[model samples]
Target chain A: MHELSIAIQIVEIVEEEAAKVEAESITRLELDIGLLSGVERDALEFAMEEAIRGSLLEKTQIVYNFIKAVMVCEECCNEFNTDDYFNSCPYCNSLKTIFIKGKELNIKSIEILKQ
Target chain B: MCGTCGCGEDEHITYRNPNNPDSHLHEHSHFHGDKEHSHAHHHEHDHSHPHSHDHSHDYLLKPGGGALNSQTIQLQRKILSKNDLLAERNRGHFEALNIVAFNLVSSPGSGKTAVLERTILEKGSDFNCYVIEGDQQTMNDAERIKSAGAPVIQINTGNGCHLDALMVNKAMKDLKLPENSTLFIENVGNLVCPALFDLGETKRVVIISVTEGEDKPAKYPTMFETAQLCLINKTDLLPYLDFDLEKFRQIATQVNHHIEFIEISAKTGEGFNQWYEWIVKHRLSETD
Candidate 1:
């Protein structure tokens, strides 16, 4: 699955932070996963946990914060969030809207053991 | 019973002896009276006070430490910026070579490789073409292209869902392509992840075949909308199949009005000339 590749990135991000902070163990990892990032949260967690073993982040906990998908109306400059990817703005029926958010995938923070 | 310093952890339990220090119930860091321990915070602190250690707490806050905060922010920026640099480099490479690269996307059986093979055999000797094939495992498509007598480099994505700019950069090193070449990258067979990654292509071509049904453009509009051209392949079998050419184009146009449409039969050589003329026009337009 693509989650495995993203999981590898998660490990790289956490390990980089751990080395910078001189931390021995990573306790928790926070991520901001976009709604439209095409990543399943549970799959990412499972992939991260499995990939972290035998690495520097053996005891890490991965927590995901999902970002809502927001689109901006081209006609009225209105922004709205919708579960449907192709739905027009609820406020206006403008087809000229562009997706503003919900494409982000980043490691927000990493909690390393404060040793 | 008295509350000490308004800290919530040392709540007065009626059954416990207040004078005995053992009555101090171990509470979570949120109620640990440390204002710095807001939510999921971790740090080192010299807590030499006479108390038991609780590493089981969700996180420990390091009091009087500001350096760690900046280091965390710096690392986040570095990771993202590194990838951004590689993507920008890829864009520059495509531009300097004067190559109008279009990333081709479709499902596995949607005839992407077939369309490419047809395009190469028809216009390969004319356009100075090259292909970068993406797949989970195997150099089969690249080998097919090499047999067709065109320069091609196969990039085994190796479990990668899509082709990123960094991968393209590595594959470019081995390609013996001339400057001003027409590069076509056939992305891994998927409709979702490939839409998200921009591989520094001049255009994105979304190929849909007659057998896949006409409702595909409406179902996967993102791939259709992002692409500059949408090619509906397999027109020769339209008589045998229920595919309507006008209906498919109309649905696609509703989603992406500006998308250019091309109807070609890659197998029967019916619309290959029109496809080649379009390619030649695009390539020749680059200099003008």
Candidate 2:
């Protein structure tokens, strides 16, 4: 799955950051993965386990925070949570809506042991 | 790091010509600046040190404390920002060279290769056309484009589902495309992953064949939403199939109101004039 590639990217980024800080090893990693980010959480976790071997994050504890998709209706400006893209506004029944959240894929923080 | 894929820059991407079995492999590694400091800002640190006087116990404990003194560093950065920055660099390069790059995306069997073949055949003589074909394996598509008379490079992505910005940047270096030229990047045949990657193209074109069903736009809204042009290919078979063109258009519009559509038949050369004209218009505007 594409999650493998994403996991590899995460590992690469953390390794680079860890090296910059002169970290002996990474102890913890926090990630923000949104529902609309197009990433499967389980697959990413599994991939990370495989990708982190023999790397800076070999023994790191990974934490993922799932963000629910929130939509803002363009017509009535009503905010609601939704998982589907074709959903309409509940208040005005308008099809025109934009996602205000739940498209984020970010590295929130990391705990590293200084060398 | 290799410039071909953003996931791991060190990963090697093989580029080869289909016609020549011994075609020299073009290998390039794009190393972004290594001097950049870590964006990690230390927010909290465990300063408690469990100092042990026993010589044997001290060897087991870390220098700062019995356990490693770890600090939580806040980054709060987008995971794909590296790819985005590389994409912006590609966009700037294209602009400086007066090149118009188009990223063509679609599902497998969507006639992307056919449409490209037809386009090159019709416009190759008038324009300096170069193509970058992305596939999991094989140089078949590159061969087709080469036969069509356009200089082509094949990117074997291995297990990659999409071509990221870095790959295009690497291909651009190997191609060394001249000014006032047109570069078409045929992305890997997948509607899901490619939607998330930006290859720094002048415009993104998503092609869907009538045989793929009318609900494709609704099912894969992200691809349609990101694309500027939606080409409904294989219109020649429209009369023979149960495909509803109007319904397809309506659904696609509902998903992406700003996307423009063109009904085309790459096999019969129908509706290609408008497609060519669209390219010409965008190319001229890009230069201005």
Candidate closest to the true structure, highest lDDT: 2
What ranges in model 1 sit over 4 Å off?
A24-27, A112-115, B1-84, B137-139, B158-161, B218-222, B244-258, B270-288
DockQ of 1: 0.10
Per-residue lDDT tens digits for candidate 1, residues B1-288, read 001111111222111112232442222111112222111111243332221233554235455542222223323332234345666787688777777677899988778888888888877867778888877656678777777766776655444456666666655655645688888889888886677566777778898889887878787766777888887888888889988888888778656767898888778877778777777777776656
Question: What's the residue-level lDDT of B58 in candidate 2?
Answer: 40
TM-score of each model, paired residue for residue = 0.73, 0.85
Using alpha carbons, what is the TM-score of model 2? 0.85
In candidate 1, residue A9 scores what lDDT? 54
Candidate 1, residues A89-108, lDDT tens digits: the string is 66877666677887667777
In every candidate, what fraction of the native interface contacts is reproduced?
0.06, 0.49
lDDT for position A33 in model 1:
80
Note the residue pairs that clash in candidate 1: none
Per-candidate TM-score, chain A: 0.87, 0.93
DockQ of each: 0.10, 0.37
TM-score of 1: 0.73
Worst 10 residues of 1 chain A by lDDT: A1-10
